[model samples]
Target: MAGIGPLTQDWEPVVIRKKAPTAAAKKDEKAVNAARRMGADIDTIKKFNAATNKAASSSTSLNTKKLDDETENLTHERVPTELKKNIMQARMNKKLTQGQLAQMINEKPQIIQEYESGKAIPNQQIIVKLERALGVKLRGKK
Candidate 1:
């Protein structure tokens, strides 16, 4: 649909008429008419809707904060000094500059420099990316 040509149809299709209002919708209309007859204020309806939305939003934020805390706790180990040294040595052995290594790993040159200089501690995901690109393990054997 995005990159192709327009379609040409051979024949026109038959049209269908709309169905009558459902029993649920008719019942809802009667309830609304009764509420109007009983004079339920519009301001009260607005306040109820606003309170419901606020409660839902607050709970969503709490769930998001819980997930963030969990991820932070999961990163237990920091990158070691030897890992930084290994990254720099591997880049040199591969005849690659920091920018070249960054390009290979889809990271910024500054980020690659920071990792090599021990200015940044990479997470496990980034460590795996570096290991794959450099063909060397930054993590030591157990």
Candidate 2:
């Protein structure tokens, strides 16, 4: 009789519960005020506002003006001659065939051969794209 009773023993499934917000969450009104001031178009404001109040308040501030100046300085530096040679060498070393390389970079096979042979100079934008695609730097006179 005892064994038969054990066969029907009740079992309950376990349920997981999430923690409730603390007291600090209840008094958090800054976000509400910000949304009100930003208006119903708050989503647009957030998207366009490059600089955020929270970001400005943080100690690690971004000096965008300084970044611009540094970028300008870097642009003026002359291209390293060795980098140009290496770019040409990399294509040859890969044994990709000029046509293959051209296809990979979305250019004509003759263009790839011309660049590799140093017969013509690629435009700045083309050089950048090629450098990234080939994983090699192609530096030349600025």
How high is each candidate's TM-score? 0.44, 0.36
Writing each residue's lDDT as its tens digit, candidate 2 over 69-141 gives 5744433333345654666677777776778778888888877666656665546776776777777656653
State which candidate has the highest TM-score. 1
* Cα error of candidate 2 at position 107, Å: 0.4
| Alpha-carbon runs more than 4 Å astray in model 2 | 1-84, 140-142
TM-score, structure 1 vs. true: 0.44
- Which pairs of residues clash in candidate 1, taking residues 3 or more apart in a chain or in different chains? none
Model 1 residue 133 CA deviation in Å? 0.5
In model 2, the clashing pairs are none
Q: Output the number of the lDDT-best candidate.
A: 1
